[model samples]
Target: MAKRFFIKTFGCQMNVNDSEKMAGLLRDMGYEKAQTPEEADIVIVNTCSVRAKPDNKAYSFIGNLKRLKKRRPDLVVAVAGCVPQKEKEQILRFPHVDLVFGTFNFVKLPQLLERVKREGRVVEILNRKIPEEEKLPLVDSYLENPFIAYVTVQRGCNRFCTYCIVPFTRGRERSVAPHLVVEEVKRLAERGVKEVHLLGQNVDFYGYQGTDLADLLYMVSEVEGVERVRFTTSHPAGFSERIARAIRDIPKVCPYVHLPPQSGSNRVLERMNRGYTREEYIEKVQMLREFVPNVALSGDFIVGFPGETEEDFEQTLSLVEECVFDQAFVFEYSPRPFTKAATFKDDVPKEVKNRRLQTLQELVKKQALERNLERVGKVEEVLIEGFSPKGSELYGRTADNKPVAVEGSEELIGKTVEVEITQASPFFLKGKPVTTGVRSKR
Candidate 1:
């Protein structure tokens, strides 16, 4: 009988995509997916260490696995992704975990599993680039969603911002070969994926073989079946106007920008080593708006950093007021392991951090609703993804990167239809199907 396996994924889209790759690897090894962890021959917990809460959750889940391991000694328990990459062999402290590997070593899943099963326990964390000789796995059979796919264009971050652990965990930035990225997009297109969200730790820094992200953007857009292309997690410094121009010009490129300004206070930003000041960041935002007038601007903001003062927090509020972001993710500063900021005294009181977090979130909520409200009475092209969790409504996203829901059946899946925004909330927009096709771009 084929062994059964289940993967529990935690974290960003990158982790989700990684889990899919791992699933594909398992499938190649003749393992079928388990409906639940209780029946699986293998259980892989793909974890995220971006925040401390997920770390606790991952540990709690691992603790539960101990009981299952006792129940089935033959069952393989593994941990992967940022947590294992960060914790290294220390993760094996959980006696139930039979295998531990890092983000850089996922392509060797078949070999790793074989070694663990034969040798009892294994830990592999390569804190460096993938060796040139190691080839990526050709696995596409396990995508979580059928119509929307995440194509990782680049891996890691070169800019070690004081508060970020991405550089330490994911290693330095390396852009995938453009042709390879295009090939992946083509294959996904063949699978009926209409929306491709190019992913990176910092997408703007993508440069491989003398070609930048703009070149890759155009390359992917040229693929026949790709209807909408989007990229994410852009840092302010490397986001050039040329890329902005490409977003304006490319028919398939979506009109959304994720330029995270971690702090609005120049002093705090300098301490964080963000490489751009508040004014410089806002200038880029303005430039993006100029190039793509209908652009959906989204951002990430950190509140209650180590030395952040009330004045510093107020500056962040002012920045939010100025940006009026369509989406704003506000995070309370928690020093992550290996980040430079962790060495600094965490002087911000927990209560103060909570207050600041709430304040910023409320402001962002007001702005997001206001920005989404403006879209009311406008017709948007939406690529229907699938049903929402409730299963009562069909969900999709606009080219501008808005989550839109409308009354429709599953037949609309993968098709770009016109949606008229009728109502808006802080988190989502309700729309009605205005037409049944992609509208011509002006």
Candidate 2:
């Protein structure tokens, strides 16, 4: 009988892709996936450490798994991802955890599982080096809709920003070969996937050692049946004027960029070791806007950092007003172990950070709503992802990556249809298919 397994993933889209690959490997080894953890012979928790919430959630989930382990003594419980990489010793202290795999050693899960089952003991496999691509499992995305998929072309980061643990946990930057990336995209496109999002810690740093992101973008756009190409987590420092020009010229690439400008205050940015000054970041954004006029820009912001003064907070607000990003993912700074910032005094008070975060969020939300409102009555070609979570309507994303909910049949899934926007909100758009019953007769 084939053993059953379950994997619960946390954190970013990259973690989701990692879970997909892990699941594929298990499936190949005759392990069927269980809908829930309670029924599985093996349970995996792919975790994150980017923020405090997910870290707490991962630990709580692990604690709950202890009951399952007690119920089924033979059940195998493994912890993977950033948390495992960061807290290997602490996680291994838990008796129920049989395998502790880290970010780099995820591809070794199958063999590690065998060892755990035979030994009736625990195994912790977390190597810091980037694993060869061939060793990683190429998992099928068992997504609800097969229309859109995430493909990671690069992994790890070379830049060690003061507040980030990714460099220590994920290692130096490395990219999958351009030929392999295009081949993967082509295969996904042939599988009826309408869109592919290229992922990386610093995606713009892709091909830095060899193959540049622009070259990869140009090649991926040429893949047959690939209608839209997107990449994320671009670093402001790595983005070049030439790359901005390529983005403007690439037809198949989406005109939406998620570049993280962690702090707007140049002093705080310097403290964070972000590698770009406020003026430089502004110039980069300006260059980008010059090339891609209608481009949608989003960014990440850390509101309060160690030793941040009132003046620093004001500077952040001033930068926000200056940039007027389409959307911004604002966060209050939280110290992580091993990062340079963690060693600092962490002088900014918690209440002050909370207030600053709220203020920034309100401004950004207001700006985002205003931006969305401008798109009202505009016709957009959206690749129908499938039914909305609420179930009565269909939903899809525009070329610029805005989500739109529409009334349509399931057949509309995977097809790019013109949607006439009727209503717009900060987060989503309400639209109807342009070619429906009345238009079909024509």
- List the candidate 1 regions with Cα displacement exceeding 4 Å: 131-141, 437-442
Error of 2 at 215 (Å): 0.3
Model 2 lDDT per residue over 1-442, tens place:
7789899998999998888778878888889889899889999999999888788899999999998899998888889999978878878778998888889878877888888878866556555665555344453355435767788888999889999999877878888888878777777777777688999999998884467999889998888777888999899999987688788888888889898888778899998999999899888888899999888888898877898889988888888888887788888888898998899987888999999999988888888899989989987888888789999999888888899999789788777888899999887898988864221100
Number of the top TM-score candidate: 1
What is the lDDT, from 0 to 100, of the residue 432 in candidate 1? 81
- Each prediction's TM-score against the native? 0.96, 0.95
Please report how far candidate 2 places residue 317 from its true position, in Å. Answer: 1.3
Candidate 2 overall lDDT versus native: 0.83
**Model 1 lDDT per residue over 1-442, tens place:** 9899999998889898888878878998899989899989999999999888787788889889999999999999999989989886568789989999988988788999999878989888887776421134433357787878888888898898999898988999988888888888888888777778899999999999799999999999999887888998899999999899999999889899988998899999999999999999889999999999989888888889989999999999998889778887878888898899999999999999999999988988898887888889988878788898889988988887788888787777778888888889987888888777554452
RMSD of each: 1.8, 2.7
Q: How much RMSD separates candidate 2 from the native structure?
A: 2.7
Cα error, residue 52 of model 1, in Å, equals: 0.9
Which runs in model 2 stand beyond 4 Å of their true positions? 134-145, 436-442
